[model samples]
Target: MPQAQKGICAEPNLHALYLMFNVHEDHDEEVRRILAQILNIFDHYDDEHYEAMVSGVIAIGSNYWMELYPGFLPAELAPFPDMHCEDRHAPVVPCDLFIQMRADRADICHAMGTAVYDALKPHVELVEQIKGFRFLDGRDLTGFVDGTENPKGMHKLDVAIIGDEDPEFAGGSYIHIQRYRHNLSKWNQLDVPHQEEIFGRTKTDDIEFASEMKKPFAHTKRTNLKDANGNSIEILRQSMPYGDMKEQGLFFVSCAKSPQPFTKMLESMIFGDAHGNYDKLMDYTTAETGAAFFAPSVDFLKFQGMS
Candidate 1:
């Protein structure tokens, strides 16, 4: 495998900064070089502040990839599967670039984010910039552990980084992101037992409900998918919660070798199964933004991004 972006499989960090941008017309080449330099800025700061554990990943939006690279695209690269059922919705709000910066220190994240913003502002329109932090020991703002089923150790590479099937894009990862705004007012009205039933787990202990006892609409039941062969399908999650007193929600990030798993899980959440039993958690959270990108191996940025 090629050298993957460090941030793709890095351990959970205390702070994160996410930025989305659209390149100006006739500036694809310039933006590519700028993106490459932003990665270098991340590496320079990470080396200088090793204890901060700084890491970053830069990705190209599916719709903009061809314009920038003028080369082959990732085989599985595709746009966000915008799906809706009744009141629940997943809409597409695309971007040309996505930069992710994470570190143990907020200051480092700020510095790196600033560096990236400074470098690319002249050639790109900033669509979004959200800073996130570790919330109560990696729990979502919803008071439940997030990424509980995320692949661990080397398994993360197996799950997230493209391999021999797409040799040219090996070490790259397909990304899907959503900005979910929670309706805490409505959700808080529910008792602890009701919340646990929706999540399919014990709140205090984070224990899963037994198969016989799991609800058809439980979150875990909807997202914990299986393949035709009865094997578990997985995505490596790097999500974090963001926002302030006025509003708050999860900045959901899912990376995988292929985009199919993310789409399937999302469909299951909104459209549900043949019985039309949707994920109960969707009732309390609104996915306000969604997009797809492919973070190529660092080697691609080093060579192709500069070319």
Candidate 2:
């Protein structure tokens, strides 16, 4: 079958759209019903200060499994057959939203986050309290602009998912969440060049190291996956800066396939493969929470028990 094309709205200004859903045999219909209801709610409540911040939900489940991705993966191992299983049913972890605000507009993000939370409280099985923040400009925990090297346009499709990673769900992928705590004091002490080396890019988003001089085994490069035939995997990243002034950093939401892209990416960061070396950014960022989950295709919900 030829790959189908759908119209995605022009990108919104939202910095992050975090989500997590528990799967079940009966929950398929419930997801559909909930999604429809939420869409209506957003339309009903749409406004300048508060509008539907969703970028559409991709239901990737099939007749056998309601393939919803959690924010993190469990520590216990699963057998190959039970790999995509959804054990917990209720309290479907709530989806989160992060909107952009002016540098000093923490109050606005907070107001919007709270408004969203209140609106969905009654309908959702559970609505996790929303969190929002102002952008820190170009600097990361290490005092440098992060994601300066992010892929854009057609290239993003390749960087996200394009490989043997999962032929069954071509064009579809998984998302992972990791809450990292930064030792800012330590990160602040590093000189500019040292900071740049850790990120494997120039301090500014522009200009990358010549191929030979790049960190061969860097997280920026290794987390990048290609298919069995060497096609790059393409996945969307909607992570955002979330937290208070004293304890702030990324909410780290990465979507990909079977957790391989993310897992392998982290592995490369911790223990670099043959050519590259472990990630230097680790000296500053400390991962505190990790979870993995699947985001099912919209059609999957229709088959499941959705009304």
Candidate 3:
């Protein structure tokens, strides 16, 4: 079995920092050097301080980095495609690198984030930086329990890591990240039972609604995808809620052996089924950015000419 990244399947803690960056064309060499330095720092501190992971994907229409590793791309790796239906639009914004730092304390996460930025400051431009946290009872900003259906234990690894199917990238995983901003004022105005109906789950108890009780456009109904053989396709989600008094929402992170599960779920939520209805939650949240990345194994990272 190939070794996967440490934090991909583990339970997240109280704090996280997600940084996205675009490498400058003229600073390719510098970026590689800085990545090596960052990786070295992470490896040196691999034990108890904090957990950090790094990954990158070539932007669509740009093969500068992909050209270095011939045929090493994830089978389903590609740029995030835009999603549109009626008045809602989920735009695709590509980034070349992603850095995720998580720990039990915000101060630790912040220190590591600062180190990463200091090393890459001259070579890359920051795209987005989000500080995520475990909200009250792990609920999202809207009070719905997030990731309630996530696969557990070895099932999470089975769902997330690439296996024999893609030999070259066996230890790697395809990831999709989205930054959503919620309309909290409007969301908070809905009554309790109505809010539960929109989520297909009980507000106070986090109990899922039975099939007969589910609405066609409910978020739960829209995201439940299955294969032709009726097996539920699953993804390991590392999502967290992030916001302040002025603006807040979810930093959606999903990892899978292939990108199909995330893409299918997303399309279903945005385009809906033959009935012509999308996820009801879309009305209360807007996806501001979308990007796809591939997190490779540690062994692969060491050999990427970083030394």
Best by lDDT: 1
Residues 1-307 of candidate 2: C-alpha lDDT, one tens digit per residue: 1121111111323343333333343444444455434433333333443443433333222211323323322222121111111221111122322121221234444543344445434433332222433255634545555455456776655554423444434444455555676777787787877766666667655356665676664445555656689865544554556666688667665554355555555655666666445566665666655554444333432333243
- The collision pairs in model 1 are none
Instruction: Put down candidate 1 lDDT per residue, 118-196, tens digits, no spaces.
Output: 9998898999999989998789888999999999999999999999999999989999999999999999999999999
The deviation in Å at residue 252 for candidate 2 is 1.3
lDDT of 2 at 87: 23
TM-scores for the candidates = 0.99, 0.63, 0.92
**TM-score: the better of candidates 1 and 3:** 1
Candidate 3, clashing residue pairs? none
- Candidate-wise lDDT, in order: 0.92, 0.44, 0.78
Task: Kindly give the number of clashing pairs for every candidate.
Answer: 0, 33, 0
- Poorest 10 consecutive residues by lDDT, candidate 3: 54-63
Residue 217 displacement (Å), model 1 = 0.2
Superposed by TM-score, candidate 3 places the C-alpha of residue 128 at a distance from the truth, in angstroms, of: 1.4
